[model samples]
Target: MANFTLKVTRLGFCLLQSLSPRIAGKVAFRLFCVTPSSKPKGEKAKRAHAAGVAKLADAERFRLRLSGGGLAHAYRLNGGALGRRGRYLVTHGWGSSSAYMADLATTLAATGAEVIAVDFPGHGCAAGRALHMGMAVKAIAAAEARFGAFDAAIGHSFGGAALIVAAAGLLPGVPAVLPQKLVLIGSPSEMHWLFKGFGKLIGLGWPAQQVFENEVRRVTGRRVEEFDASRTAGAIQRPVLIVHAEDDKEVSADHARRYAAAGDEVRLHWANGFGHRRIVAAQPVLDTITSFLGEVISDKDAEIIPLFDLPARRMSL
Candidate 1:
């Protein structure tokens, strides 16, 4: 069934690509922007979501609505402490349910900090056919309003890009939702990388690609180039911890390096074997990230520098 679905989807894309770039671009924008729900990923993923929620102490679950009938499934775990212990928001990658990130969210909940997680539109129980950066940014703001400001925001893949956008004041509300501490795992530095790769995979020409990006600009009010994390990373003074496995197959590990290069105290955690998705659920990765989160929360004087692991055979740049 999965193979058949893949083949059919491919055939549909081929047919779409055969059309003029303008028409194809508009069609592609709608198809790609729409998110399929999180129902398809199977039992293990479902169990993970349940387990993550079970792990949360005093979990508060709710639904949030956005423009165009988009919805977000949100979860909140209050800080173990009585008073204000700070709140942390967790957002997962594209095509990923918030359940996929429940592990980290629950783990953060173990600390005294309030932990929050949300399934973006078209992910998990959120009702939408697709998701785009603009919607993701809106979701972040919505989460902020419901839970108050975030002390830190942890995002994986697309979530990281949204965080950068929120921090950079690139969204609708100037100063959208800013987290004092930021964590980005396996994040893409630029949308050009994603669009270019998708274009090649589907045999989309430059004209189609440009048209698609133009459509994105028209819908989101932001150009593709503006999504680059490195472009605005330098100005964000908040301490950042970027973890990317050397073997990450999706977003390049260099994204971590580039983010660090953009400056403002980025600590890169270079894992050796864990790929993009696994990096998020890895125990060591979680420990490293939570440690950084704690440091920023507890130590006013904490400082950091660039970090990465190079192949033993290759000389460091």
Candidate 2:
């Protein structure tokens, strides 16, 4: 009877999820837990595997040394050409470096868009001890000084949240650098829920979730509720493309829906079975981004830089 009752409860929860995805997402985020791997021996191998997977393109790489900030960062720029009107600045997620977005950058470049991919502080070759949204925004500003204003900004996971914070001017004196179009991939709308889910993944109990929230509040000096993308969506007047995978076990797809619900300018694209990381590399995802940027270029305000014109490697197929 106990097992049967559990099964019935699960079925009911599933039915509720079908009926109300947002509420169901909150529930699932609270309940679902992940356990860390016990095999310490595989850590090095895992890092090596991750590095291998990150190797995507052979684009020209350059370093940007920020003046006065005492910081130096690496960036990968592809499809350099004269009279290019627009740029695509890509920010990678937590635990990922600029190399992770190589394929997407390559695809965007191939579609006649100059792509600027940067490594956030404390990641990749960037010289920093810790990563913060302020530093990331500074990096963007520095990049803008060198590469000029971007036509569109695409961020993945944590980078997506940082993108919002950057555009909202949450960091004082940091001017809101608004892009004509914003693309958020696998970004959660609520930081509290996301941190709670992260706690569960690391075996943190309910108490830990509360502590995590408190810490976040103390650090940011703002209530977690204030960061809801749904509430702040109206502040962003530019068109937004929110992409998420239906099978994503990291960040729920409902977060995308919340972003879409926040404003009519937002469009939601739901992909299936690509999981979180693979969704970024998917061809369909690339095609959609290319099409969006192409439209922006057609507006006559933006310039397009074709990859074939670059003096780099020649395309042989």
Candidate 3:
């Protein structure tokens, strides 16, 4: 049924393209921005989602009203240790909620770091049907205003892209909420690649794609290709730790390579077999992130901290 629906949807777009490319492009772009449902499907899936939510039961839940008239739900976990390090922000990917990030948030919170995880407009408990980077940025800005600047931010996939863009202060009117450090796991380097991928998914050819790009520019006030997180990372002087699995099929490892070449302070960690989503909860990835955040290097003590037994390599450039 899902396959049939998808085929029918594709055929509808094809017919629309034949009739009016402009209208087809507009509809395609709107459909492209539609947020996926975060609700659990079956009984087993419901149990798993309930478990994820249960993990955040101890957290102080709150909501921030976004400038775009949407509300972002957030969960704040206070540090367990007496010597609190600092506040940290954790943002999940598209089609994900703050509950999904509970593992990482709880881990960070356990080690004396106050962690806040947020659900962007349409995801999790936040109410909305559509989401874009602009809305994501506004959500982050609202969080900053409510809780103040975060010392570090860890983002997975789309959340990472939004984090980089918000930190870079690329979009006008929205003030930058740059953290002291960053962790981008399985993130895309630019927006055009995503747009191109979406084009392929919807069977949109060059004419429709051109119209889509024009619509993108109208919405973002910038060319689709201009939203490069790698370029933004280089421009904004901050230490960034990029964790990417060599086996990440959803997002190419080439994106991580692009980020590694972007700046001297950027460090890339290669994880094996974890793919995109699992890498978020993988022990080695978590260790690497925490070490990156906690490590203090003096001239005499400059050496790589020994992490987990996982086959991982770190590149400092």
Candidate 4:
């Protein structure tokens, strides 16, 4: 019976591979998959876990109404008295809520940076449909309104792409709240390739891939062929850090390489072992970010305030 079950599983995978090469590639990508490191285990661990869970639940329950876009909700974590320290705005990926980033945010805040974790539309406390990149952009703007301009912005996956658009001065009519520095975690330079690879993984064929690409273009107002982060990376004019896991099963490391090729201002850090989402929680990645912040903060002569110095308060919102 065990042998039969193994045979069936192998056959199933083979069938999937044959159905879509992109899906097959996704499977190949999954071989490098790394789950997020679990929280510590102990009495203190239990208490901490419980507290974190409770805070997440409470944040989810709190709802806020958006003026033009309709009603939505968000999780607002006020990092205790960073005082005059700088602020960091964090955005999570698709199918994930702000809760997933709670660990990362807490860690960064502990480093004397004010961290605000935002829930994109339709994912966390925010209302709406899933994968709505436009709404996600708007939600980001709204969050900025509440928290003021961020010194640095970090985004994972889809959020990374949105951040790129925001930085490129693409979102017209929307208030430009570009961060002094930007970090793209597990972000792909080519949207078409990423989507195609993703669709293939889920057994999508040419027709499905094309349709999805069309919808993406319609929503973003950018064609798949024209969507190149390398070109846009130069326009950012801010120091950009591109961090991706070598073993990432989602966005490949090649994406990071392409982004690096685009400009000299971009910095690429490849962390091993950690997969897409897990990279956020990985200590090494956190350390890199912390170190980068330290260097940027120390370099006073630098035109761009190295994401560490807290900006003066503006009376007008």
Assess candidate 4 and give its lDDT.
0.66
Of the two candidates 1 and 4, the one with more favorable TM-score, higher being better, is 1
> How many pairs of residues collide in model 2?
1
Clashing pairs in 3: 264-317
TM-score to true structure, per model: 0.84, 0.69, 0.88, 0.71
- Against the true structure, candidate 1 has what lDDT? 0.76
Error of 2 at 212 (Å): 5.6
Best of the candidates, TM-score:
3
For candidate 2, list the clashing residue pairs, or say none. Answer: 85-303
What TM-score does prediction 2 earn? 0.69
Model 2, span 187-222: residue lDDT tens:
878676766545544444454445545553444455
Clash count, one per candidate: 6, 1, 1, 2
lDDT tens readout by residue for model 4, 1-317: 26676566456556765676555544433331222224434686456556555655533233544435644455545444435567777888866656666676776777767777776656655655544444566667776777677778888987787787766756446565688778888987866676665555444455435555666455556566656776787777778899998889878888888888878889999987999877877889888877776534323444444443433422111
**The best candidate in terms of lDDT:** 3
Candidates arranged by lDDT, highest first: 3, 1, 4, 2
Judged by lDDT relative to the true structure, which candidate is superior, 1 or 2? 1
Find the 10 residues in a row with the least total lDDT in model 3. 308-317
Runs in model 4 deviating more than 4 A are 1-72, 79-84, 197-212, 295-317
